[model samples]
Target chain A: MNPNPPLPPDQPRFLRLFLASEREVRRTVLAMVPSLADAEDIVQQTAAALWEKFAEYDEARPFTPWACRFAQHHTRRWLERRAIWQRLLEHGLAEELTQRREALRPEMERRLAALEKCVEKLPEEQRRLVTGYYYDRTGIGALAEAQGRSVEAVYKMMQRIRQALLECVRAATAQEVEA
Target chain B: MCAGCDRAGGGGVNFPSPEFDGAVAAVCDGSVLERQAEELNALLRTDAAARDEYLWRVELHARLACDADAILGRDATAVSEPAPVAQISWRRAALALAACLAVLLGGVWLWPRAASQEDIVELVRATGSVSWSSEDGRVRPALEAGARLSEGSLTVEGAASSAVVKFRDGSELTLSGDAELSFSDHGKKRLTLRRGAFSADVCPQPTGHPMVIRTPAAEAEVLGTKFSISAVAEQSTLSVETGRVRLRRLADGATVEVASAQSAVATLDATVKMEASSRGVAAARWREDFRTKPSELWQGSWLPAEGAEPARMATVPHVAATRKDGTKVITQAVSRKDSSAGRIVSLMPDSVLTMKFRMQRSKPVTVLLSRHESSGAFAGNYELVVPPSTGQTDASGWRTVSVPVSSFIAKMRGYQQPPSGGQVSLVYIVCYDAKAGMEIAGVAIESAHAGTSTNP
Candidate 1:
């Protein structure tokens, strides 16, 4: 078995502790809460309360399991207050999946920033096409007419643009992880 | 029916319309297979494998779209509302189209449109200076040197390198040095600071008439009274000398009011912090001191000759007249015995003071100067007596007597000392009972002066 390593005690590092075990703790809290919204609220509250109680925690042990136990405690307390929200807690998969989604937020935001930069560097005409479709709610058919091209041709262009952007975001995120 | 699909199958779905395709692209995140299925459903109809592949492609697309939205939205929202920018671009396009159409349709006449008052006002600056000239000879406002303004269309040239502009309400705005200013607005009251530092003591016009100062960074609105605003490329500061000013971030629409003697700063996406400015309430004594410098009944043209020697003309033939209503309304043309003999004593009050000119007799007549109660003394106790002409042919004009209350009461005996510091309390002219039918023709009392004298 891997020996429990000690966290640095010299400086306040509760933030690091919270970040490291957020996923498991969030999942456990979500399982006991009804609705993704309620689960998210409960997990946030539990994290804050747990951080305040960090002085009571043993630093040498695994952080994730310990935080999960605290999260479960708070989730049970939250469920006790409202009967209707407790009913949503019966659907175990929904709550569990939502926690996974919440855990992926940091990764998603990072990827999103990367994809945005690549899209902006596109040629003005292409940028317009993308903006017209995404922001203006303009259809490819209207874009086709404006460009004096067939609808099918516009569709093909959009498909290529989408593929290019996806590739760009993926590459950027991969580079970030490596760095 | 939750059909789990992938990216490859998206191409096969025969979408009802292209708008549906764009909507799919906007809402769906490409990494989510569930969203990918939704996108493929909008685009095509296909087998489960194809649908799954298509879902993958859409998931990728959705992710890409999110990225694009974030990057662009961040940069764009950091600027002003996109609607106007978009409209500006659209206007440029429309102008180009109009130009082309004008050429095709021959002989199109475009009327000359005069720029708006907002355009004219925008030339005013919070700081710095500018010079303006107008061949039309209309007095216009200028900007201070090195000050900046916003985009505006109206341009007015200064009469000189620098000159003072007197607003309609007799307030002065000084624009020093060579300054150029332009003001523009879209039929709304908006100001664009074009150039130079120009200071104006603008009387608060009606509401909705906003005084806006535009700098490179943001716009400052003078909601009320006095303020001085200055702007550079990266920062804009509005300091209120008096009253209040609201500094608005034109880009982000954030606003903060700078109260009396306080300054607010606007830069980039940062919050504004108001600081106390060392420059306190600007010198406004000039405005208060500048009374419409009183002129003669005739404009201000009449003046005493430089070296004229004064000679005494005492008791020159005098006359007084009773009005049709038995009120002694005296005029120089009516029943005047002498015009030059009346000792013209000027009464001017330095501050607020009330005084009464009395002509005592057993009975009194209405004292009228210029056919009106120059003072309302007649309606009260004293009988404003109109003295009849003893001999002369002209209207009953009496020799004007100079009697300051201090000197006149000193000669007579009991009068109370004026209360606050030596502020003169009252002025009384006693026509020693010999002039029974005597009329107090003209009496003038205003902001008081130092010494007493008679007009010979």
Candidate 2:
């Protein structure tokens, strides 16, 4: 037997398109569910649903919107089953957000690309702070404790970093347009 | 004080309110209080700008959260602890007094304690003939999976052997067979890949200290990425799977930026050869939304070879007036007589070209992949032909085409096959036999394979 069997041609094509839109689906799910673990779970479920119903999908249209709809469906079902958060968006609001996301997808992608450049341009200390807070999932209180700083000070620093990042992204985006 | 709130109080400033930031941060971290939650909801309901900012922050946060490892050059599981600043060796008297004070004060004391080695990274997993040598030159012949490794050198001795070293900051380095690497965290995260091949899945390094992987002929300044570096005698090759790597040839101090799906080879006394690489899978695929002007994304020059008219191409607001959706497409019209009238783009290796196009006239479309050889001659030219039936001409709807890199390699022309490991510098979509008017949208070069390791 072949150690690495080739995937069915149709399967690779469908998977390529699916993977291309995977980030958008995950981002949508994350916006609904703040918890990374929960969002990941929903994304996994969405992927399964997408694969199961991929044959039914019309190839004429873009893949993102379709994938996002499946993601939203899974997200809503996950939220309902867990009753995780009371402040979760209603179906109508969720649908509205999805449509808005679809319209702004291109711009959002541009911003994301700009963000990578912006992040590289950030000051070393600020980058570490971001890595700790966001990537490491270290709580603000824990970070404060580790740094021997007040929670408010850390929060203020985080706000400053976010502000700086936003400005940098905007500046980078402008430069990209200019170039 | 909330800066946005203060600015808002002053008069007209479009800054996000401090309350908004705090609420967003709290919500993102899953630590929102009831009052803060209520305020956040109310703000989202009332303020459209706030909603937009919320979405932006959410997207940014998600992106960062997902890419923290590549950005930080640390392992996801490595929860970094505060480094102990001072160490003091004391006698029994100090220890007794500290214990008594701790008991009296309910386990809280302000006394200076001895510094501990809590921040040291360990060899969490090792397999198949892996050994380590300590800073003191203590040689350990074989290490178990959970062996503790401080600042030291590790060697993977045999074929089919590998070892994984986990750093305190959550970064991981996987050394392939016959590889030797020394790591030190004296100041910044540093690793010297002395010989053989190794893949690093780095977490975001601290701002001042980028992870530097030094080989004999070159050094790669890693700013958080999943990359593989192989060093053998005279040459060192760096292949970037995700993020960016700045490779500097040690012989002449020449540097080049290698982005995702790109690679560079550094050799002694030679200009480093920057090539496209398709190794260890693609972490993120490429997609071109025609939202931006064509010139911004692709080479704008249209090459009209013999018997071909100048191809008319423009970024139109919509492909057709029939579809009212606010989207854009690159519309190209080429004469039937033209053999080489199309756009050219620099593409990475192992890319599958996918495009949605609506052709006005049914004709066979040829997509050509080309590259220049070391001798400054155009060596590799590969073509994939889409039959007229497949390259649909119906204006009512667009047809999609997916062409894999394997197909291009299999169909390459000339004595020399296209280099399987480097970048393809030029791509041409030509309609030679018919007057082709095509509206192209969703042109993308997706990765052939998903990355091997999952993001932690």
Candidate 3:
């Protein structure tokens, strides 16, 4: 074996780490911006900002938390520029939430894994509703009109489904901890 | 008992208050109101339990938003059920011959026999400026509602204009303004939607004659269903309201079967991707008729808030009735001294609040619904000031109003205090307006359902 193995290029390695942490970065941005469309815009901005400053990233440090800092910065700027009605979190509150999220990252990962299993256990109709609302990005008004139900009824169904998912996740995570 | 005692003494140590759970649940679904938001924010800032629940909900909401496809088991390479191939191919051949004969006969010979073929469609409703062009490329103003067009292009211009076409086979197509589409009966029953949005309620076609709607980027083949197709320059989206649709991307010939309440998208350079239909829930019907006295059904007393008027029950004949029930009504006469308000306790969380009432005078009338805990403490609520032009009253002047339980949840979320539990103990309906007489006959809370009512 060679005593001095060549190290990976900084740019390519940084890109790998950046891409690997994309889910966490997106979650960080979404925590600040409740709207998925706005969060996606902020995520794009964060990616660009992180790429520009990739030289400053220390390889010894963890990449996900570093990437999340850039995401939080962009999220704050987006919140400042957004309309009052659209602003979900204040700057100070957003900062605190980010810190709390960072501390709970491992636990969140566990819960998310549990959530996947729980989501599969949902009733077919409820699963479709969740997928349509979150994945398909169908507007609530349009969905209500299509389903011939009131927007309120659709929202209620979603709430119940979410409640079930939360309970399922809690139970699953608890079982994992015990195991 | 004091509020603090109610919180600490009601439950054992380490157990979370029911109110906290309700508040957090509302937050996860984004249904909290502003006032409640402030309270929950303060609690989240100081209370550890509140913060923990808030964090959990926030993470749950974020994960669902960002990774829904993964969670919902949507994989690009996943195969759908195979479509019936032999039947489709044979039907196409039969329809192609009929289309060829219809084209050869010209407009005059086929106009009278169009009804028998089940291929002709008529413009039954036109709003604003709609125009159409025949096979010769001559543009003509779509003047009336009953214009029959066999095989040509129809265009609806202007932002406010729209046209509804009823096919001879009992299907309906509603085209929004700035939309252009060409229909042909020659081959398979096909309509080329060039641009803009249109919703189609297609009747089942004779096998082999699937209705094919083509956009710039994709083709949607339907046997029978209600669906909407929207096309822009870069992308085309198909949302199926009911039944099923097969969408094929022109670029790669990749196909996906979109079921009822599912959607699919095709881009100019990308394969079609199937997704959950962005549409809302199925139709729901929940009604409560107060044929029995309100006091017998509801546990809580109707107590007016500070400076609010008390509600009284009176007998009225022939005021508008949504259900064909009796004539006893709940009447509230608003004055400068009081706002009319009443509260009912122990309601199912999934229940919807529906009321039948008529405004004696056309003044600004406001309706507020507030949710409370079992101990009569505030939780969250929604407030709506009735608009002047609702205009849904029948000839006798009675109108029905239905409010979904989720509306209150949404309002609570707006306030930053989402409810967590599956049960609500108190509901308060408040009316704000001086000297506005409001007559309410039926007030009931009923569970929600899916699917539309034929009578509604």
Candidate 4:
């Protein structure tokens, strides 16, 4: 690493902890907000907030859970300002979501592991679609336009692929459980 | 196939969930209908099982969609994609073929800094006046060819100017026409191009940290790709010539993965949604009826085609113009330069530019075309000045003007020649005065012989 210059002494520590916990913390925010875009924004804001408050953090305890707490706070604050999120949050779903998402983390991780194989198993056409839309980050509209399909048609195909992958992962998990 | 997903089946209650699955998929796809959002929220709000499924699906989406490399591996993701930067020669390459600086310099650089300064990048080539400075506003040193630079900012000034740099990793970044790039290969390759255009043929980066290019409106995360970026204050546009790039708009945190030959725009203020990113407009196809989707190529004051026929109309924008005295001028005309994140089509010699609009008073409308060498350097500018109409107009009061490419007089200073063969990059329509009440309803750059309707 080229000493990137500007830093406090503990900057490396903050970077190490943040990089490790980023994926989990991102999942937490994704659970809060429906938008991957907004989740990314909240997670970025949470990272900034965490770095500022790093001195206050009890380093002995796990940083993942601490970063997650900040992520949840930013997600809620982000949601609070938007009228679209107002009705969604009226039932006070954040706390329940945080609690429930933690409960599902283990199985979800297993399913995520299974997804790699399942994705590889997809037909080349389907795999390219996944790579283009999911990996390449092509928008649904752009994907539709490129593939010469209607936007609705593309969404339906994506739904089918996700659903198929879900089934494939579940089967793989079941085989593991049985074994 | 399993009947239903059961890992999402904890709390032991599995409500038949095909409909729920569809809703969650829509959420992940960003195509969730308003009704679906409400329904999906209601299910999550009321039931724990639904929330379990939601978390499960979203996590899967997050890993597969956002964390693609970690899940699929780099080898699987990077291959078989568009790679437009395939032809770069390692020792030196022209920036957009716009720079013949390497041939001009003979030596790679004008001068190298003191040996003590860490040489991280090589200015392999440059054209016109290129400036260099440290990240902060100070340290103004004029940079020349083959100069090894410590991590800092570089700006290629003038429409005709360009520069290409080779990084420590052999990655090549090209800056064209009034663009500034502040770059560092420190921990990972990161470039901040706040304004103007930057193109690159990136070398594959480390597994986790991809190269990042930040503009005012968005940032592009590149994992070894051939791409070009153009940005103004309000928007940053990314066009991927090869491979793919993920462009995230800072305004909405929205990101789109642009693939080869495709472009995506992230805007900070414009209300006009981008129509098409794929740009291969035919000579006859180059038209603006002000209907349906608005092209990213246009910016102007538009109005509904009133009186004649009530049909579909796109957007209405106000186009202000410069008066002869240079006062009473809005001077801001709809331009190809500002929104030129699209097709780089060269104008055939006989190309005719036309416009349909209504003016409150008779005023001369000026059409200006900014041309560049086929190599992408600004050659000169030409203008066609149409005198105020003394012709009949339809009941709607819209007058049509069509001027062939040959009619445009050489109006450029410093360089004077007709723009007969140069690639036409900038096209705009201006009027003598904004108060002349000109509202442009349509415009087109067409081959001279292409049929055009004359509004009676």
Top candidate, metric lDDT: 4
Residues B1-456 of candidate 2: C-alpha lDDT, one tens digit per residue: 111222212222233766567667655655443345445555566567777777777777777765554544342223344322221112112333343334334435323211111123445444346776766555666554435555678887532345666664446676644578988775577888888777676766667889888999888887677777778787787767778889988888888888876667788967445444443322324454344343432432332322422223322221111111322222332111100111122334566777665556777666655443221122344667888667443444667888765576523112244344333434445554334665455555556453221211
Provide the global lDDT of candidate 4 against the true structure. 0.62
Per-residue lDDT tens digits of candidate 2, residues A1-179?
A: 67545543455666567656766677788877765545655665666567557678998999999988888787777656432144435434455555666677688788777766677677766776786776555656556655656455776787677777777887788887899
Which DockQ value does candidate 4 get? 0.12
For every prediction, compared with the true complex, DockQ reads 0.03, 0.09, 0.09, 0.12
What's model 1's overall lDDT?
Answer: 0.39
Of the candidates numbered 3 and 4, which has the greater DockQ value?
4
Q: Which prediction has the highest DockQ against the true structure? A: 4
The best-first sequence of candidates by DockQ reads 4, 3, 2, 1
Docking class of 2: incorrect
True contacts kept of each: 0.06, 0.21, 0.23, 0.27
Candidate 1's residue-wise lDDT over A1-179, tens digit each? 43444433622366556655654564455333322334545665565556556778898998788887777777767656532233323334234434544565576556656766787667767777776665443545456656766544676687667767767777888898999
Model 2's A-chain: what TM-score? 0.65
lDDT of 1 by residue, B249-362 (tens): 766777776676466666665555434343322110110111222222111111222253111111112123222233332212111110111212222223221122122233
What is the fraction of true interface contacts found in candidate 2? Answer: 0.21
lDDT of prediction 3: 0.56
Tens digit of per-residue lDDT, candidate 4, span A128-148: 778776555565655665676
- The CA root-mean-square deviation of candidate 4, after full C-alpha superposition on the true structure, stands at 21.8
